[model samples]
Target: MSPHSSNDGGFAKAAGAPAPQTIVTDAEGLDAALVTLPGGAPAYVARPGEGDTYPIVLIAQEIFGLHEHIRDIARRFAKLGYLAIAPDYIIGYGDPRTAPDIDAIRAIVVRVPDAETMTIFDEALAFAATKGGDPSRAAVTGFCWGGRIAWLYAAHNPRLRACIPWYGRLDGARTKAQSRWPIDIATALKVPTLALYGGADPSIPLELVEAMRTRLKEAHAPAEFIVYDGAPHAFFADYRESYREEAAKDAWARALAFLRARGAG
Candidate 1:
């Protein structure tokens, strides 16, 4: 086990949690599972059943943690011939999945240190190598809370080929655990990044998104931002009421194109 992993426990079912999406990707042609990594980190791993090797995609989960939506995303990546791994980095503090409300989930989220998260991702990469993943061909995509993480990870790990963050926060309070936001790291990004945002997201205003864009441009970072005019936060989360199919599909397609162009797909 890696020294960085936390073996607190697995995810707990949240009371009154919304039902999963009905259009989830299946494992018909994929090898997928909820497995324990070498460091004892829990993760949902998915890959093409017939492939000996594939590009790797490290998926970051929303505040809800490694729920059905995240797992489904992994399957979708696998179907596209990528080895997708979604590690449960927050299980140590407590299962955010079990939180009954947004505030309850935030309590668990703030405790997760950004430094520790980078290590967990490192472990995920190690595990991916053993599962026929091409370490040199790796990309990351995240949603909600994970979307913010995707931006940080891109800045932290230069080896990543690309990063795609779906409606991640651009600015926020600086806590010891989470000292930086997407906007703070814009100048430090080394990998090509594609950030998606909802124009109607009350949590992340347009001005902040533009501020991030300005920083990235000043730093000459290879980055792009796509804002859906009327989409709400979590537009890609089909299981949530905020899901916007048109925007989600468009974003997903653009993400794939960006990854491929950046040598990750």
Candidate 2:
């Protein structure tokens, strides 16, 4: 099935909704805008300084595509001195921001295939290389749905130095399109991965998380999974109700250390 395109119409926040925060300010040196991914998907890219090669970090979005929250994330990474690129993996599908509710967002997400999303990620990596990024030192990080992709990408691309998957589902009912779960690919991973999850997330059961840990142990995969005591899914998304500041801050610190230790800095 062909992917759906986002319809511009929807209930956008009122003008009074809090103004979005800016995370980076190298105005003269930074380049910020949409760049085309392979297969024509559009991705937002942000860089810290001109002519300086920096480690690349692909910031995968939640089901929301490259919305303001995701954009802010890219800027935050840029401020940290990495070239961060966030692609609209769902460009072929409808926009999650336009969805009236969660069901509509899920409908769009389910149509996006793992293979297709990986291709877009590859494109984002290529785009980063052209903008002064060290391709050999690339890393990826994501939230929620993007988190699962981060794990799969580590297995898919051997050049990746590290991966950080935040609050992603570890196991789920299989579908024809999603042939392998993160646990299924753990043994084949070429890079180290750190998975941060919420202990109380209903969407991802604690049992499944334990199963993933067991599989990783048996395979001796270079992976680590941490569960925050009372956090819920999307705890890192400061814009939503699920945001848990304490857990999110801790996870972010761990993620940075994980990536840098793997030579992504």
Candidate 3:
């Protein structure tokens, strides 16, 4: 409900991460709050003061869950005149921000079933509809762990106008829970997506990007993949050392254009 608290939850500052942004706590015009889903799931929401009804963009969080960086992303979308929501989709595994190490976070996160996560997204959309968010003008975009989910959600939600998946893994070993990788679902994507990726992300090899690119082309999916030279994973996260200002700025422009082109503007 209040501005994001980096100290309370979130990984310890990564080396060379920019100092966290200061919140103008008393500022008006934009309001951010928490909302509970039908089955008691929690989500962070931000909206502009001037809109009676606005385009909606759901921002899926990175592996860090609803950390300050993720909250800032939702706020960014809201300031752009959207009803932006970021659901802590990592429910039931305990707060990711509370995990002591990255491996610990992954151990719990990897156990979440895709079916449950997808259902939560549907619940999120229903929640958005109640808050002046127009379902017809809906868009979804996400980073890291969330970026991959954006791809899956695009396939699952026919109503989404656009999707942007930023730096999520393209191929991975399948488990019972995460049965479909991006490559497996490329042909099924239902809307336009501006796929932003880092050419140099070690965790996500360029081979996988190219593979996904080829699959999208073969399937004639309405999506475009653009890789930023020399950038690495989590490049849009200014609060991390991996942030690349040039790539991040360019991706932001493309994301706005992609969503606005479809209706999320």
Candidate 1: tens digits of C-alpha lDDT, residues 208-262: 8888889999999999999999999989878776888899999999999998998
State which candidate has the highest lDDT.
Answer: 1
Alpha-carbon lDDT of model 3: 0.82
Clashes of each: 0, 2, 0
RMSD of each: 4.3, 5.3, 2.7
Per-residue C-alpha lDDT of model 3 across residues 72-135, encoded as one tens digit per residue? 7777788888988888788677667766778777887899888888888889888888888999
lDDT tens digits by residue: candidate 2, 134-155:
9999999988888888888888
lDDT of each: 0.85, 0.79, 0.82
lDDT of 2 at 4: 19
Candidate 2 — which pairs collide?
4-92, 4-93
Better of 1 and 3 by lDDT: 1
The TM-score-based order of candidates, best leading, equals: 1, 3, 2
Query: How far off is residue 207 in model 1, in Å?
Result: 0.5
Off by over 4 Å in 3: 1-27
Error of 2 at 96 (Å): 1.0
